[model samples]
Target: MASASRDEFHLIVPNESQSAEVKLGSDVTIPCHLSPEISAVDMEIRWFKETDCACLYKKKEVIEGRSYQGRTGLSTEELNKGNVSLNLREFKESDMGVYLCQVISEDRTEEIIIEVEERKDSDGQPVNQSSKIQGRQVHLILHESNRTWGENQRMKMEESALMTEFEVNYVKVLHQTIFKVFKNQGKKLEQTELQLKESKTDLERVLQQLETITEKFGLLENKKDLDMKEPQMQQIEKQLLQITKYTEEKQNQLEEKDTQLENMSKQISEKEKLLESTIKEMETSKQQLEALRQEQMRQQELLEKKEQLRISELNEKSKYLEETKSLLEEREGKIKSLEKEKDRLNEELQDKDKRLKDINAKLIQTVREVEKKQNQLQGKHTQLENMHKMLSEKMRRPENKELEASQPDEQETKSKLEK
Candidate 1:
């Protein structure tokens, strides 16, 4: 599987060593050039350490990770030309490691090693030397100022002059280097400060927006409170059910009473035409039956009116229920709309959080760079002081040697006079 995967991927890095050296407290680029150069615009380029512990880019925009946040980026201008170099700021010993740059679009990957070493003094030596004498390997003796000694002195003088000239040139180069670094640091610091201020303002604005969203949510909650409660609707439905049951019972009773009255009318018609002997008895019975009929008629009228009143009341309650249902439907729609709005606000809030994180990372990286530069400046200052002290000691040595040489000549002349 590994072999097959390797065959599908091709990237280019320096063949020999692929190692770039950088001094501590400085910035450096770890190059990962593309083979068969082509425009890499919009390509997903990722720079990572130790198999992707830190991510430097997702595409054109840099992706800040815990380790490389604010400290790593690409040159936006060069990206179009296929330059995928990872630029790391404030190089330190901790940063000396292998980094990989993978081009996801092209399915290619490359690695570069960075070596971070300490900065040397102006003389290209360690800066902890206490005195110039510690650097000397041998001592010299003085003699008379004769022709041979003078020739030797002249030769030494010429060598000293050459050494002085070289030291001066070295110091000049060092001065230029320090000056350029300082200038770059100043520009970076100013840029960082400006970005920090802008980010602070943006964070404040986002907080305000979040507060507004919270307030709107509170208003929606209050509206929900004012709407009809579900428990109340249930209670109304139960009352309607009881009324329908009672009305059905009353309708059944009225239907049974109508059937009974029809049967009795048939009996009365048949009996009225019976024999003359039974006519008198039937008259008495008819009179009593007529009175009962009058009473039943009155009761029927009252029941009919009561039934009509109940029907009307039922209809009115049903109408009210329908209206309440419509209102509930409308409220449901409104609640749905509010929910959608809330979701949209949540998405916006998430986006703002991501922006804030990116800004914070940049700020942190900038502060680190500033501190590194300040330390570099301090080191340079110490180096200059050491160089100045060494130069003064050198000047004093030559004068003291000349006095010793003159004293030797006087001693030889006094010995000759005694002889």
Candidate 2:
């Protein structure tokens, strides 16, 4: 039973009322097509009259029961397209029972019950089932003749609207299997209300018919009191009772449909509120995305500016080192030349020591001046070396990676300058 209910969710069948009225000995096709149709050629289809199996079809061949051997059959081609409309050639009294259509697809089984009734009327014609119990989400039978009423145009509009509702539902299911009711809930609520109004009208008409039938029953009772035919009177009473029961059931079903519509309206309101909430959340997410983009742009600009400034500082430091290095070399060369001249003068003055004592003091003064010049040159070279070392250390800092890459070349240049 649990499996059957689950299968109904997957397998949509057009079930009106459980019972179908047909003329005695008439060929009746009970429509049982699967909605959102799929191929059912491999499924095991069986029609059982209570406990006795009427017909059964496996994969290849169809086996008929002794009770309805020639009478029961299913279309092989229709089975391939998920349609298993059972054909009862001669619907007899024995065939009028609660027959179940048990279909085995893969592993799960689904069964739907429908009754085949023989209508006993004056003309033996089948009574119209729609006029009696059309409120049940009874999809018109597959390829059934279109029933035209006195209000042809109005009836067509109602049918078209109802069919549109069904199609819309099918489409929604196709699009989204979950949260499906949230979509077009408003539109569907309106359609349900329209159907509800129509059902009310139908209920009123059935009420009037019931009242007229009650009057007829009273008349029949009066005739019996006056010595009317027993058999005829009893038959009429039976028909009237059946009609009254059917009408009462129909009225109840119509009322149920009204309740269903009201429930739908309430659901639509809830869904509408939910939709509004979701839209607000979407707007919030959009705003957050925009803020993140702006932050990324701002950080990128800051990085670029910092990079440009570092490049400028690296160029200036490199140029300053080059200039300082040349100046150190030039001063060292001049000091060395002055020292060589003073040393030669000192040697000459010593050779003429006895004769030029007065000139010796002037030579001593020149030697002192040359010594001072050499000492100043040595100090400048030491200071320049210290500055160069400090500059190289600063270049090796992590943030100056690009500048540090050229540190080897700068070191080689310093070595050459020292040489």
Candidate 3:
């Protein structure tokens, strides 16, 4: 019996590692498998709410309880074949607890667990809240919650007063620093001016000495003055030669400028003609573009007119289609009526054919009866003719006998009288 009970019962439930969460008011399926060695025939199965220790089902029937009524079911057909899965419908938040499936055999029991979860909103809040985070106004509340103590009204007032005091002290320090820097810069500027003036005086004395040497060389024409101060005169002559070369370069540049001016005048005249031609081409292009734009506008108007005509035609076609549909519906009704009449006539024809076949059968029976009576009458007629013929022959035989007797008697009488 223990072995028989072991073969008839098995446990089906989620293991500790196989548990999953399901939202409330949704459908859930708990997969359970029976041992292959066990047959579910004649075995009692039960689903128990493990948290409250309440029975959910027993022997394929739902147990009546507030916690388990109308909530639990099993695939009974599959259960007999060792599939021990439960189907739970319309789950509730109160169902968020462990569940156990208990199978009772002849001598043993088995159990399993299922976990349920309550439903949550997209923002992870409970669904029953009036001010859900999904609402637009809830963002303002969240923003207000994010403010720090340092950013509050009292802290701002304290920080402003402190900042004003610090600014006054900062301005006083800045003014002192600026005044010291300006006094030092003024002393440095005076020394720089004295140095520049002294350098300028020294440069003017040197320039005067150079001018005297240049004038003396310009007057001298003797070889004795060039020999006694030949090096000095050569230096002065080099300086004058540089000045002359620079002056000649400036004169050449002026002549090149005059030639460039003449060339520019000729180029300007050609460009003016080209500009006039370009202006004419631009005017022609403008006229062509204007004509093209007018043509485009005319074509657009024509297109609009064509579209309007097409729309009117489509409306007419729609009206015609509606009329045709109504006509088709009427024709269909007429055809249906005609078909019904045809069916009635066909039924009547079938009835007439049946009657004709019955009448023909009756006529054939009556003709057969008449033929039997005619055969009996023919036999009676033959018998009556034979009896009449026999009677006539008998009557004639007696007459003939009487005549012979009378003739014989008369012959004898006459013979006697004559004798």
Where does model 1 exceed 4 Å of error?
1-9, 15-21, 106-419
Residues 7-30, candidate 2: write the lDDT tens digits. Answer: 442333465533453454667676
**Mind giving the per-residue lDDT tens digits that candidate 1 earns over 219-294?**
4576664254445435545654554554455455445444544554454445434433354454465456556656
lDDT of 2: 0.60
Each model's lDDT: 0.55, 0.60, 0.56
Each prediction's TM-score against the native? 0.25, 0.29, 0.27
| Model 3 CA deviation exceeding 4 Å by range | 1-267, 287-338, 387-419
Local accuracy of candidate 3 as per-residue lDDT tens digits, 1-419? 12333545445433423433434466666666676444564566555444232333344543433345566666666755666666767754454455555566667766555544334579987445443222212111000011222223233333333333333344455556555655654565565455545545545555676778657765366666558776765765675565456545545654555565556555655655665576567557646865776787789889999999999999999999999999999999999999999999999999999999999999999889888878876776675566457555655777877577556655764574455
Cα displacement (Å) at residue 218, model 2: 12
Order of quality (TM-score): 2, 3, 1
Report clash pairs, candidate 2: none
Better of 1 and 2 by TM-score: 2
